[model samples]
Target chain A: MSLRIPSVLVSLVALGALAATPLAAEPKSRFKVGWSIYVGWMPWGYAADTGIVDRWAEKYGIAIEVTQFNDYIESINQYTAGAYDAVTLTNMDGLSIPAAGGVDTTAVIVGDFSAGNDAVILKDSTSLAEIAGRNVNLVEFSVSHYLLARALDSVGLSERDVRVINTADPDMAAAFQTRDVTAMVTWNPIVSEIAAMPGANLVFDSSDIPGEIIDLMVANTAVLADNPDFGKALAGIWYETAALMVADTPEGAAARAAMGAASGTDQAGYEAQLAATRLFADPAEAVAFTLSPDLGTTMDHIRTFLFDKGLLGAGAPSADVIGIELPGGAVMGDPANVKFRFDATYMQLAADGAL
Target chain B: MRLINRHPGRAARLFLGSLPFLILVVAYLVASAARLADNPGDKLLPALSSFAQAIETMALTPDRRTGAYLLWSDTWASLTRLWAGLGIATAITLVMGLAIGVLPVMRALLAPVVAFASMVPPLALLPILFIALGLGETSKIALIVIGVTPFLIRDLSLAAAALPREMIVKAETLSASTWLIALRVVLPQVMPRLLDSLRLQLGPAFLFLIAAEAISADSGLGYRIFLVRRYLSMDIIFPYVAWITLLAVAMDLGLGGLRRLMFPWWGLEGRR
Candidate 1:
């Protein structure tokens, strides 16, 4: 009763091979964009659920797929890996990961920046300098880590002065409850939760760095170049949604409430997160911010931090490994290897009623 | 030649055993090729060359920032925690399991409590452990011990209780003291079963270890996997997962070999 299993396996393999042949073709009209849970990027989910994304994409005769990722790093990773055409990421991550990974990316939309959203709290102390010689828990290599470095710099100290324990974001809130974790750097919701605990004091926040920690909607440079309509539609969708979210009307409040619910928080919690987030409500203002001289200065700090942290890729002789092209014909780092292009043309068009 | 002739279908049996693995590899390759053909930058089903490159970077090369080989260091850190947790659990289970299995009074007092405690998911107790034990090696190690100890106790107790009543009667007939009988008669029989129970608990132990490390730790196989997951670096992740599988397989094989070598009679009966 010996069965000839090999023949059956071979036929199955042949069938799979035949099925795989047509999957190599690309989908020209479809584009995927990934977003993670955050105060600024919550509008993306709202736009997708409310049919706003489809409406804008329909105007351009294209389809947009909005994907949400629970993990913040995964969104940027998918974008870098070409699984998504665009992603929502912070300015520092945009410079460190995708651009450093040799993916040409464009900052199409400056969504918002964390003002007081990301913060550092102490168990009993009231000052940043008091953080020295204490175990500071944070998600290492995240925006919170960058924020901690800047906080330490402000106090005439360095990372060497304190020991950082790499605690996951979900655990940071409860980890702070422990007596050993005297200090912690984390983002909103968790930061708010920990701050409410007895004896916890907010000592530092992203407000000190102002617009340094910029949140953005960045697209693959090659994809945007091939289909400029995608960028135009995305920018239109973002500005429209941003306008709706900030408006004092009932429609706007309802929109914000939907975004809040999508982000796993209630309206009040979402509103608190939004209050700490400085939204660039106006496209003109966003364009101005992109073209401002402050961007270059902020990028310089970001590039320096990323390079120092060895996030600029191995064998990076200097911070000049990945070049960034600003809006005003300015290039930071090596122009020969420019990967991050800050093009404000789409935002400008949106502002001038041309899009 | 005699052994080969005796087992005429040995080669065929070996090939049949490996067919499933061969099919899995082929399927993965076909799927990966299709993805790479569509998008060469696909990280989920990365090409084998990319895995080689990733391995060279993470395993061979020293990290520019930390100045350590990440794979080896992570393995060492995880192995240390795992061994420490298992070692403590084994000691506690051996002592308590023997008493509860042989002494009816001890079993009545502790068996139900152990059963109830095991029902509560260990992950739920992670925060409590961190708060009580602090965010150090102690909490992580305690998580593994707490997760696997109850199952080990239960299994060892059952094995001990299932031992022949005639052996105990004979020992008592020979005027054997309780301590001497427990040690000379029971411990020898229980040692092999303890190893068997430990082998069964390894999967759960690894689960508890990874959960703890993923929640909080600077370095561990689990920590590294979760960390690199953010980058969607599947190349690195694939190799790390393969390495963990290899380590677990080796540990299981080693325990099986030890069981055979130390308790041939018990091993023979178990095989039967």
Candidate 2:
């Protein structure tokens, strides 16, 4: 009956003297990617600014659109609800939302791990040990929270020894300035602003614990399965963009400035922010970062930290939740084969000057 | 003399004032041991000290030097957005209330819908409004209309219903038209009630305005709070909140004065 209706409509339309049309090219495969206004995810804004996103999308016969979010949590929330094809998220939120919600999602590319970006800012003369019993402001259960927890472990203190105030990110700098907070866990430019305040000092940062503040491009498990080629194309484009960023060129500077502007910072400010984030200049390095043997031990610490903080729900999540696997061949999760393959196969082709 | 006349409420005032002192004393005693053992001051004290320092640095710094738009921009931007939204809402309420209130059948049909709408929290509609209207002034105006029109409808209905039966009867006996009776009798009766209703909704409209402006807005007082929150700028947040509160209070006073001036016969309940 449905088939008959379309045929009848086609015949009726044909009678109306409109062109008995030749079939049209398929509509562009428009995909929306969401990212928060963070320095780590500057590449997303840069790709959009440099026209690399659209160029790559056109090459793959797809149209790519990017949406920048003000709040990291809301971006993850929107991503979890399948509002976007992919989203840039911290390793923790990536786990809490898409991973925990039973959505088979894969972290395709590792962007940059925080080095000195996430910091424990304090006022007056104080060591990390001296921060005991002080109220530390941070968005609870976020990567900065983990950074704070890790900072405490280095000083032989527990996060429990200090009061944790559930302050949002945008307010952290002001909190530090107000001196109402003894300490706060946050990222730049707020970090830079607070560090500039007289009597303010950075007690610790992600640089103190490398490879902890991981950023990734996460794809929905189902969409990835249906369009593996699009995944490969995205991986190619992301690495290409990263390569351009690290190289010395006018385009790179312009792209960096655009990212800085989007983040409400200047070129120098943006470069300063980038200096603190350990960006993978090459996709092979990113791939290596993903598969390190320490990934297990560190993620165990992360998972345990999350479970203790009540960010992870119910049971303890297994280490396999990270889902690290080689690209092309191996499939981990069922049906969609959720792959965290930061494999440089496509990126290597994009680099060495090949697409 | 007024103080003596209001002396019966003195016990409540004293209790309220003493409550903070009692809390402080208990808190201090508990923190004294920590202060002695750790040689650290109380958290609130440090928080306040830092806040004062931040205020002196940021708020005191000239706008040109600090690149701040100044506190005045917040007041002006927020007030302009709210006035525009309120203007649209008032238009909607006036039209809908007039149409629905005069006809008893229309009033009966809409009473349940308006009552149900009135029960809905305005903030809850923000996301749906955003989706439908795309996070612009339109959404804010739509929400304000949805938030306020129901009260106006209800008030106008009651005012129309309370019209003296003798006036209607005499109008009918004199072979007066419905339109003539409505303009001459029903409107004058409803005018005072409408003013009261508008005044009552002013506070709620302001509340929803601030909340809506807080979410996804780039400018306005609420946005100022959110923007400053990223830096934990509680000093700025608190001042902006206080400013909005003052604006709301002033609007209430102004509306009350206007109500008294416009409707001389209405007592404090309506005049306010």
Candidate 3:
């Protein structure tokens, strides 16, 4: 109901913008990066609050605007619509949403992957096999759903065996309290909250199928190509904040506490979440992971999954419709129509202490 | 001449009524075409061809996994929940509204509670509904009932209470008891008003139903919109919204027909 006011205001602003466009047209030096609440991506918010983002931007003679979103998917959608120059999302989402939607996106940083943070929790179910016939509840088409698909595949069962109930994240916890909802697949801190329920069994998690659900900071390829300094500024801001988040110093402790508070938790709660995530706190490790051969295999799996779910753009006959240019000039999908790329230059620069 | 006296002919009135809609459609098309020309993949405003393809895909083609044409199944699911919720609310309101208005004791007890409950935002209890009633159709229906029942009761009760006191006195003089006066005098006046209250409450009921479904549901028009929204599929979302509007308009028309058939004398400007 409140949206109507903003919609009317937006139209007025749009009309005003039309009149002001001529005077405002200039070379773009400022970039906006959209991020949502996540353990791996929390550093973006912390850095922005502490002026690390602006400091790096000043160093590179550019201005970077880091904004936080309450919704994960909304940030990605806005980024895909050209409202933001960059966004933080999982590799699967990057491929399925922006890449499939014809936005040329490139990963500037590989943050972390879920180890045990995401899970499939079943009430009174002891093993993954018990989940065969039950309807799996999750945020449909999200990483949780992808995890469920992978979980079912491990046991030789396909999506045909069980129905997928598309439940929202806010309702998943309460829905699980009802006896009718016996099984759910979700991510932490939701996963951690659900696991504490009586008779709840954590049958499978991202830890079991590691490195597939990668967290990344992806930017528009055309925008990055025009302004290399924007990429450098982002890499600089990230490494500095990443170092502080995991350090044993008091300042690091304070950084973690602020991030936890910003993410709707406390210090200990944030630490518990960090324990389940495989955070690449080191720049070199992040670069190594981005260039690894396993990334190719993971991308192959992701593209195939997206194609099967019909998320790889409309009328896409195969997974090859959206090309993904990997590191070292190797391309997956159609080489002629590359839209998603895994670029490692900025991260490599960060690793070599050259950023 | 006064502005109220300057009325158009029926043909002119129809054209005037339709002018705004035509202008909106033309504006949307022009904006969409311009966006598409700049970047064909703009999902914010989908092209006309994209809309046609989306409509065909959702309304005509059967889903791959479920083998159900999404449009019909969603409509069936949503309509069933709406009917069940509104029907149960209307029945409860008729009985309670009459009791509260005709009987002093019932009014003293329920009027305060009804006012309080009506003020409580219905969406706030959505999670509790899921927790208490489970995630099935029951919780979704319960949300709608909890959302609109109080208002329906209030409307009917006021209509019942407004009956001239002399009628009740005369009925009592003829040996009509409390129950007799409620049945003979109050129910007759309030029954038609119940229909009006139900008609007014349809829009709000649909809002509650869609919110519940969007949060959690296996199938519904709201569920489909939120589900495909993960991929930013505006192509599908726009059409599903239009279909829901059309369905709501048809329902309004149906209720208006029922009102005319059942009680042709009852109307907004007092009974004929």
Candidate 4:
């Protein structure tokens, strides 16, 4: 009996040692980022394709996994379902999906805002005002819809002034060919493709409404709270890439091609596309863009526009609902300044050109 | 009266009875015409027609994706997946139903749980299932079993309850074993009703099965419909839906025929 007891104790000790060994070992972050084939996410893809992802991830000592999704909604769905740690999303989609799905997330980095990459292509209509009482097709509640509403407001026309057709992005180009839709508000390469087609005129583009289209590299709130250092490192990598991209020299052209190849676009097309997107190379400028005094007003516009269009749920766009600041000076929030954390320490350091 | 009856033709009555159907067709055509008039370039009708044409085109082609050759196309792959899922679900339900049906105490304890599970909408658990089992065949099959087994158990329990207590008593009195009595007395009676219930469950089972296939699956009739929807090829989608409906009807007929063959002279009214 005495011998058996000692042997049992030894066995238990051995099992404990085995379990403790793994626990003490280094754990990989399994950093998962979700992306759709949008233009803004070209950097992440470029980083991966050019092996910059490895260097950044290694600098932070984590294993990063990138997943490409065909549709924006699917990426949001996966993010909501906890399949992704980070995602590329627009300001409104960030609010709609992660926030609405009850998962607190943080918008960490400001990607390029749309300049002329998005447009409302009209057939036989020269001006926005001429589109009144005509069918204007677009995916409902998408950025295009927001752009269209803003475009219409500029011309003093309401949504009721035109017939809104529920054509999704993949079908919008084809829908235009059918001649059923007189006008369509969409993003490129759909916009570029449609404009290339004979007789399709650009009624309005994102250039008309500056700073309204904000894209971001957003992280789940819990992940950001636990790893501010990692966030800083990732931000360092992004700003460095942006610096290379905006140079517009021989090196800049190479960087452009790297980004272009990731998105399956040609070098010339990529440069043209980049020209239409105003990127903030300076971290201070990016931070200002997020926390500008006009941000509150911009969010209010988004809220009122979405609410009137029956898109936003019944509630005011409360700041607290949009973002919460962490213990560290890291800012996490909704894109339009309603929900934001202003942790510029990492971005500030990166602006000094340090990784 | 005799002269009028002599002049009465079966053809005249048939023609008179068909008038309502003809009127319905005309009304449908008129409504469609009005819709066309409302929007000349509305492409919904032409899109639907093109989709139908696409399906007919694809069906006749011996191409790999979806052609007349079932072995060469997605038809075989999808059919195999569906049947494998169905077969596993049927096996699980049968075993569970038999276990509960054969035991009165188990029936009392588990019938309500099974009933509650069946009452829950299977589609509502889709996201949960996706998270748990992923977009794989396992989740899809698991859903089918969850949706199907309770009704089978309920019916089997009732069938078991209907079996007389006297038979077991008599068997015990004669020194015959419990197993012997159950096998001799209960088994024969339950088999007929079990087959009947199986036939009845075919409709709901197929409905839930198709719905499960529709959500997040990469390949199936549901996937095919959605893929064509992306391209606005409704012509193919329509014919595919029609073909699937016909396939389901054929299944129903086969099951009905099998039921008749097995339960000959049972005089089972309202079997469907």
| Sort by DockQ, top down from the best | 3, 1, 2, 4
Query: Model 4 scores what on Cα lDDT?
Result: 0.64
DockQ of each: 0.34, 0.02, 0.50, 0.02
Q: Give the poorly placed runs of model 2, Cα more than 4 Å off.
A: A1-28, A314-355, B1-272
Please give each candidate's TM-score: 0.87, 0.53, 0.95, 0.52
Model 3 chain B worst lDDT window (10 residues)? B33-42
Instruction: Show how many residue pairs clash in every candidate, following the order shown.
Output: 0, 19, 0, 13
Please give, for every candidate in the order listed, the TM-score of chain B alone compared with the true chain B: 0.93, 0.74, 0.95, 0.75
Q: Rate the local accuracy (lDDT) of all candidates.
A: 0.85, 0.66, 0.86, 0.64
Writing each residue's lDDT as its tens digit, candidate 2 over B142-225 gives 777778777777777767777788989999899988788887777776777776677788877776766666554545676556
* lDDT tens digits by residue: candidate 4, B157-187: 6786677788667778998775665566666
Worst 10 residues of 4 chain A by lDDT: A18-27
- Score residue B163 of candidate 1 by CA lDDT: 88
Chain A TM-score values, per prediction:
0.92, 0.83, 0.94, 0.82
lDDT of 2 at A46: 79
Of the candidates numbered 1 and 2, which has the greater lDDT value?
1
Lowest summed-lDDT stretch of 10 residues in model 1 chain B?
Answer: B35-44
What tier of docking accuracy does candidate 2 attain? incorrect
**Native contacts present in each candidate (fraction):** 0.39, 0.00, 0.58, 0.00
